[model samples]
Target chain A: MEPAGGSCLLGKWGHPVLQAANDTFRLNADFFDYTIIALYFAVVLGIGVLAKRQVSSSIDFFMSGRSLPAWVTGLAFISANLGAVEIMGMSANGAEFGVATFHYFWIGAVPAMLFLGIVMMPFYYGSGVRSVPEFMRRRFGTGAHLVNALSFSVAQLLIAGINLYLLATIVNRLLGWPLWVSLIVAAVVVLSYITLGGLSAAIYNEVLQFFVIVAALTPLTIVALHKVGGWEGIKDKVQPGPEQLSSWPGTDLTGISDPLWSTIGIVFGLGFVLSFGYWTTNFVEVQRAMASESLSSARRAPIIGAFPKMFIPFIVIIPGMAAAIIIPEITNLKSGEGDTGGATYNDAILLLMRDLLPNGMLGVAIAGLLASFMAGMAANISAFNTVFSYDLWQQYVKKDKPDAYYTFVGRIATVAATVIAIGTAWFASNYDNLMNYLQTLFGFFNAPLFATFILGMFWKRMTATAGWTGLVSGTAAAVAVAFLSEDAFGSASTGLIGLSGQGASFAAAGAAFVVDIAVSVVVTLFTRPRDEKDLKGLVYSLTPKESLVDPDAKALPWYQSPTTLAGIGLVIVIVLNLLFR
Target chain B: MSTDHDGTTDTTPKKRAGLFDIRFVIAGLIGVYGVILVLLGIFNASDEELARGDGLNINLWAGLGMLVGAAVFAVWARLRPVVVPVED
Candidate 1:
C-alpha cells in the first residue's frame, strides 16, 4: 500500500493509496490563480479593518452588542455555521451519494433551525445567560457548566482547524500554492479580522460573505446544471430510483439492499444526537441566540436562519451531484489501483471546479469557496476567545479584571486559538481525506454532549455526578464504537430521518445517556438535592412568569422548549424526507 | 441576576432584555427580507437564462437587489416606530 498511482489502498499495484497522496501535492494543470486568491484575502482583511472598533466590551466582543436584527443574525448564522469542513463534507457526500446527500439540509438543518426558532431559543433566552455553558450552570450546576464549556471549546477548535486544513487543500488546488502557504494565508486573513473586530466583525463580514457565497454558489450550480444537461439529462445519466437518491428509510423500491433500518436509525440518531448536540449545545450556535435583544428575537433568529438552511442543499450539494455525473471517470482517482476512484472527497471537488468554471468567473467562485473556508476559522477563533476570556480567565486568571483587561484577554485568547488552529491545520495536512477526519473527530464527543444537554434541559433530576458519569460514559461508548464497529459509526448510519455513519457514534452516546440518566435519578433520589437556592436561578429561566407556581401567568409553554420541539420537529422532518424522496 | 418585577427595574444595575424600540426595526427588517426573497422567486429570470451560463450575472443582480431592498426596508422599519414609541 505504498506509492504507485492514485488507486485503491489494496490494489494490484500494492501501493495505489501512496501514489494518490503523491499526486495530491503535484499542482493540477489549471493552477496559477493566485492573483484572484490574493484579492479574496484583501477583501477579508478590509472587513477586519472596518470592524476594528466594534470590540470595546466583552459583550460587544463576543455577542455583537446584542442589538442585531433577524436578517443580520440570519445571514451571520449561515455564514458562521458552514465552515470549510461543512462545505467539503457536503460536497463529498454529494459526490458519493448523489442528490440523496441533500438530506442533510432537509432533515438536519431546516428542521433544526425551525425547532430552534420555535422552541430552544425561548428556553436559552429565558435562562438569561451569556453563553450556552452558562445556561448549563443555571439549569444544572457548575460542574456541568464547566465541563461542557471546556469540552465544547476544545472540540470546536479542533473542528475549526480541520476546516482550515480542508480550505487549504482547495486553495492549493486553485492557486497552486503549497499547503503551508495556503494554511498561513488563511490563518492570517481570518485572525486579523477576528482579533480586531471580535464578534461584530465576524457577524458583519459573515453577512457580506454569506451573500458572496450564495452569489458564487448559485452561479456555479447553473453552470454545472447546464454542463451536465438538465434534470432530464441528470436522470438519464444517473440512477433515478432509490438506489441513488432514496430519502426514505431503508428497504425502499430502489432494489439496492441497505443495512437494516439504515435510513431510520441514521436520521433519527442524527436529529436526536448530532443536531441536538450542535444547535442546542455548541457555543457558536447558542451564542448567536444569546446575542439577540429579546427571548423572542432569539427564538425567531434560527427560524429566519432556516430559510437559507433549507436551500443549502440545492446550492452546495447539487453541484457536486452534477459533477459526479459528468466527471464519474475522474472520481476516486486517488483510491489507488482497483479502488473505487483514485480521488478522495477533498480532491474530487477541486478537480471538478478546475475542469468546469471559466477563467474569469473562476476567480469569483474561488473567492466564494475561500469565504466559506475562512468564515469557519474566524467564527471559531471568536468563540474560543470568548470561552477562554469569560469562562476560564475571568473565573481564575483575572477575576476582578477591568473590561479593558477582558478585551485584552479576548485578543490573547484569539491569538492562542489561532496558533493552535494553525498547528491543527498542519497536522491535518498529513491526512489525505476530509470527511473521514471531520466525522471521526466530531464523533468522539458529539453524542455524549447531546445526551447531557437533553437531560439537563427536560429532566430536573439530572445531577452533577450524573453529568460527569454521562459525559465519561458517552465518550467511552463513542470511542469503543470508533474502534470496534464495522462502519465505525458515521459512514453506515447517515440518512434523512435515521442514522448514517454518525448514528453509531450517537448510539454509543445514547447508551451513555441512558446510564447517566438512570444513575442521576437514583443518586438524586437518595442524596439530598442541592440547596433550593441553587435551583432558584434555574427555575427563573424555565418559568418566566409572575411566579413559578402561578396557574396562569402566560409563561412560555413546555411545547416551546427546544427539547420538546425537537421531538415534534423530528416527525415533520421525517415526513419532508419521505415526500422529497 | 436580579430580574425586575412588573417589567420595570428600579434597583438592579444589570440591563434587561425586552420589547425595546429596536424590536420594531427588527421586525421590519424581517419583513423586508421576506419581501425581497418572494419577489426574486416570482420575478426570477427563466431557468434557461440561468442554465445558459449567466450564473454570476443573475446571482449578482438578485443578491444586490435583495441587499438594497432589505437595507431600505430596515431603515423604514427603524423609522416606523419613532412616530409612536410609547403607544407601540
Candidate 2:
C-alpha cells in the first residue's frame, strides 16, 4: 500500500510533518486577484437582485416558472453537480489512482445522463409533478413519497454543509484566511442570491459559474502540461506502471493497482446501478432538467449536458495525474496513523494552483474555485427549499396556501436549510475521513432509488406497496453491505467485494438493486396491481404517445434528435476509452 | 398539458429589459475579468510572469478573448432580448 516513492520514515505520528508540508504550500493573493474575486461576487449579487423581481410565485421561485430553454438548463444541469469537492477530489484521485479516476465520468456519469434524457424525462416532465417526490406519490402513493422527500431533504442539507465546510477549509489552509471568515463570506454571498432570486437565480449563476470555472482552470491545465513537457512527458514521468496512464480496468498492468472495477462491476455496478440511481433519481441534478420550457426541452437538457460531462475528466483528472508525476513528495504523502510531513492527496488542485499559476491568472483560477463551491452549495440549498416547501410543509403542515405564501415559505426554508447545513458541516469536521464516509452515505441513499424508479416507471404490475418496500429494503441492503463489509473485512480491505471505494460502492449498489428487484417482484406477484387507468403518464405503458414526443422535434433533422445526439456522445466516449486504453 | 396550476393556459409573454436580464450579468463578469487580465498583461506583468506563461501573454490573449465573448453576449441580448412565453 506504500506509494511508489516509498514511505517517509518520519515517525508513527504524521500530522506534524503533514502540517509543516501544508505550511510550505501558501498562496499570496495580490490586489488584482482580490479585485477579480470581488467583481465576481458583485456580479453574482446583481444577478440575484434582478432574478428577485422574476420570483412572484412559488412556481417561479422553485422551478424558474418552468420557462428556461434547453441550453440554459443543460449547462446548469451539469454545473449543479460540479462542486468544489468534485474538482478537488477528482484531481486528488487522479493523482493517487491515475486514469482509473476517469471511470467516474465516463462509466459513472455519461450513460446515466443519456438514459435520464431519453427515457426518464417523459415520465418526470409530462406528469406535471412539481418535485421528484411528487412523482413518487403519483406512482407509489403517500408512503413512498414521504420516504423519498425526507431522505432527499436531509441529504441535501448534509451535502451543502459538507461543501461549505470543505470550501472554507481550503480557503483557510491555502490563503491563511480564518475558517469562520471564509464561512461567513460564503454564507452571505450565497444567501443573497438564493433568497432573492430563487431557483432561476441559482441556475443562471450555475451556467455563469460553469464558464468561469472552465476559463480559469483550462489555462492552469495547459500550463501544467507545458511544465511537464507535454502528454509524452506525462506518460514517462507519472510512474508505477503504464496502467497509471490507461483508463481501462482489469488489464494486466492495471489489475494490481486500479480498483475502479472489473468489466462486470463497471457494467452492472457502475453503469447500471450507481450511475442510474444518481443521474436518474437525485433531485439536486434532475431539478435543472425539470425546469426546461417544454417536455422535449427537458429531455434534451441532459443530452446536451452529456457532451460536456464526457470531457470534464480531462480538465479535472489529468491535472492530478500530472501532479503525481511532478510533485510526488506532496502527492504521495499519506494522512492519518502514519506520520509524514507531506501534503494529503486532497491538496492536489490547490498545490497545482499555488505551484504553477502566476498572480493575475491565479486570481481568476481561485475565483473559479470559489464560484464552483458556491454553485454546489446553491444547487443543494435551492433543491432543499423546494422539497421542504412543497413536499413536507405544504403536504403535511399547511395546506392550500396562496402561491405568494408558499413563495415566502420557500425563502424561509432556504434560510433554515442553510443554518442546518452549517451545523452539519461543523459536525462533519470531527471526522478524519469525510470523503470516504460521504461516499458510503451516497450509496445508502441512491442505490435503492434507481431500483424503485425503474420498476415503478416500466412495470405496471408493480404495486405501490411493492414500490415502498423495494425502496426501504434496497436502501437498508446498501447500508447493511457498507457496514458489514467494513466489519467482516478489515477497514483497509478494498471492499466487501474486493474493489476500490467507487467499485465497492458499485458492488453495494448492485447488491441493493438485486435486493430491491427481488423484493419488488415478490411483493408485486402476491399483491394486487394498481389499476392501469390510475397509472396514466406515470407509467410508460399507460402514457399516451403524444405526451412523450415533441412535435417540434419532428421537423428537425434526424441528427438533432436527443437519441441521436446521445448516441453521438456515446460514440465519442467509447473512442476516448479506447484511445486512452 | 400546457396549463398552469390555476387551470388556465398561460399565454402572456414576460418582457425583461436588457439590463435586467441574466445575460447582462454574464457580460458584466466577462468584461470585468477581461479588463483586469488585459491591464495586468500590458502594464504590470514582470519578465518572470511573461516567461512563466511560455513567452505568450496568456492574460492578454485570454482577456481579449473574454472581451469578445462578452461583446457577443451583449449584442445578442440587444438583438433578441430574453422573452419567456407564458403559453406553449
Candidate 3:
C-alpha cells in the first residue's frame, strides 16, 4: 500500500498549507543536481542574449522575420504546447483515466494538426498576415477583428498564468521558496527573454526546451515503468477498470459515465470541435507555423510537428499511470478512498519524479519541468504582446505609429501581460486538474472562433455582421452552458445540469460550435456580403490553385510535399490508436 | 535533407540562426549535462542510490544515451545547417 519497497522519496505535492513546514523540498538535490540545473539556466539566458542581437525591427521581434527553418518551427510548434498544460495536465488525465488519456494526442491533437498543415496554413501563410486577428480584419473587417483581438489577448494572459503557477510550483518545490515569490520570479524570467529578443528568442528557447522536456521525461518514464514492473505490473496493479486500460469510450476522463455518450464526446466534442478549433484557429500554434521561412515550410511545420506529437503520450502518460500504483498517496486516491493528504492527479508526475529519480536524474527532471513551464508561459506572452501591439493598440489607441514605436509598445506589453499573468495564477491554482480549467478556456475562446472562421472561409456570402455577432453569441452560449452545467466553472457554477469535470467543457464546446454556425448562417442571410475582390485569398472557393499550394511542388520529391508528409503522419497516428485500443 | 554547403552565397548570406546553430546550443547543453551525470554515476552513484533505481545505474546509462544524442545533433548540424534567405 506504500511506495513499493523504497524509502528515500521526500518531496510531496506542494500545498500552500504545507508552507509552514519551512523545509518542504525534502528531496535530495545535491551538488551534481545544482550544477546541471545551473547549466540549464545559463544556456536559457545565453540563448536569449544571442537572440537579442538579431532584433532590428518590429517584424524581427514579432514574427521572427518569417525566416526560421521548418525543423525549428516544427519542434517549436509542439513545444509551445508542451508546457504545463501538455505535461502536467495530460499526465493527470492519464493517471485518472489510464491508457484512455491517449485520446488527447491521437484523437484530440494529431488529426487537427494535420488538418492545419494540409488545409489552413496556406490561407494563413499566403495571405501574409502577421497574426490571426489581422486575418480576421481582412476577411470579416473591424468588428470580428476587434472581438478576436480582445478575447485572444485576454485568453493568453489567463493561460499564461496556468503555466506561471506551475513553474512557480517547481521553484517552490526545488528551493522551498514561498509560492508568491516564486510566481513573481518565474513571470519575470519568461518576460525578460521575450522582451529582449521577441519571437525568435521564444522560438529558439522553445526548440531547446522541447529537447529539455523530452530528455527530462524520457528518463523519468523509464525509471517509473521499471519500478512499477512494466506493462504487466501496471495491468496487475492500478486496476481502476477495463475502460481505463483501453482507448475507447473514456467515461472517466470525460466524466459522462455512459459508454456511448463518452465515446461520442471524445470523438465529436474533443476530436472534432475542440481539437480542430484549437489547432487551426488558436494563434498560440498558428504563429509558430507562420514564422517559417517560406510558405512551403509554413505548410509543413504542423505536419512535421505531428510526427513527434504522435509519441509524446508514451513518456508523459505512462509515468502518470504508473503513479497511481507507485506513489502511496496517489494509490490511495485511485481507489474510492478519498483525499490522501494533499495529493491530486496534478501531482502525478511530480510524485513519480520524487519516488523514482535520484539526485542527478532528479535535476534533469526538474530542469525539464521548468523548461516546459517556461516554454508554455513564454509562448503565451509572446503571442499576447504581438496581438496587443499589432491588433489592438495600433488600430484603436495609436494609429499611424512608426514600426519602432510599436516594437517599444510590444516590449512594454510583455511586462504588463506577465504582471497580469501573475494575478491570474491565483485562479488557476484552485483547479485540481488543470485540464478542466484549460479545456473550459478553449471551449470559450477557440470553439466560437473556429465556427466563425470556417463559416467565413467557405461561405463568402457570410456578412461582416454575422462574424462578430456570431462570436459574441457563441461565447455567451458557452458561458451559459458552463454556468448552467454542474461545476464547470469550479466555485462559480450553478450546478444545475448533469455535467461536470471535462464533460462539461465538451458540452460547452459542442454548444458553442453548433450555436455559432447557426447564428452566423441566420445572420448572413439578413446582411450584405463583402466585395468578391476582397475575398480572394481569404475564402477557399475564391482562392486560386497556385496560392493554396506551391506551384513547384510537383517537381519536388515525395518527402517535400505537404500532402505526402501529412498522409504518412495520419497512417502512423491511426496505427498507434488501433495498437493502443 | 541536403549536404552542408559553405553557408555563403554571392548575394551575402544571412543565416537563419545568425549567431549560432540551435543544434549546437542543444548539443552543447545536453552534452554538458551528460558529462556531469557520467561523473556523478562514476563517483557518487552509491549502492543506496542504485537500490532506489532497482539496481540500475540510471545516471550512467541515461548519461551515455544523452551523450550519443548530443553527438547525433552535433553531426546533424554539421552536415545540414539551416539555409535561410533574408531580404536586404
Assess each prediction's global lDDT (C-alpha) against the native.
0.57, 0.75, 0.80
**Runs in model 3 with CA error above 4 Å?**
A1-25, A426-442, A491-496, B1-19, B83-88
What ranges in model 2 sit over 4 Å off? Answer: A1-24, A250-261, A331-341, A433-439, A487-500, A557-560, B1-17, B51-56, B75-80, B84-88
How high is each candidate's TM-score? 0.76, 0.90, 0.92
- Give the alpha carbon lDDT tens digit for every residue of A231-276 in model 3: 8888888666566788887877777888999989888888888788
Screening candidate 2 with a backbone cut-off below 3 angstroms (N, C-alpha, C), the clashing residue pairs are: A13-A339, A14-A339, A17-A341
Q: How would the candidate models be sorted by DockQ, starting from the highest?
A: 3, 2, 1
Candidate 1 wrongly placed segments (more than 4 Å): A1-40, A240-242, A250-260, A328-341, A431-442, A487-503, A537-542, A546-578, B1-88
Query: Any idea how many clashes model 2 has?
Result: 3
What is model 2's interface RMSD? 4.8
- Native-referenced Cα lDDT, model 1: 0.57
Expressed as tens digits, the lDDT of each residue in A354-412 for candidate 1 is 55544434555676778887777777777778887887778646788688888888898
- The per-residue C-alpha lDDT of model 3 at residue B84 equals 53
Candidate 3 A-chain TM?
A: 0.93
Q: DockQ for each candidate?
A: 0.08, 0.28, 0.47
lDDT of 2 by residue, A419-483 (tens): 88777766666653443354345446667888889888999999989988998898888666755
Give model 2's TM-score for chain A to 2 decimal places: 0.91
**Residue range B46-73, candidate 3, lDDT tens digits:** 8888887798888888898899999999
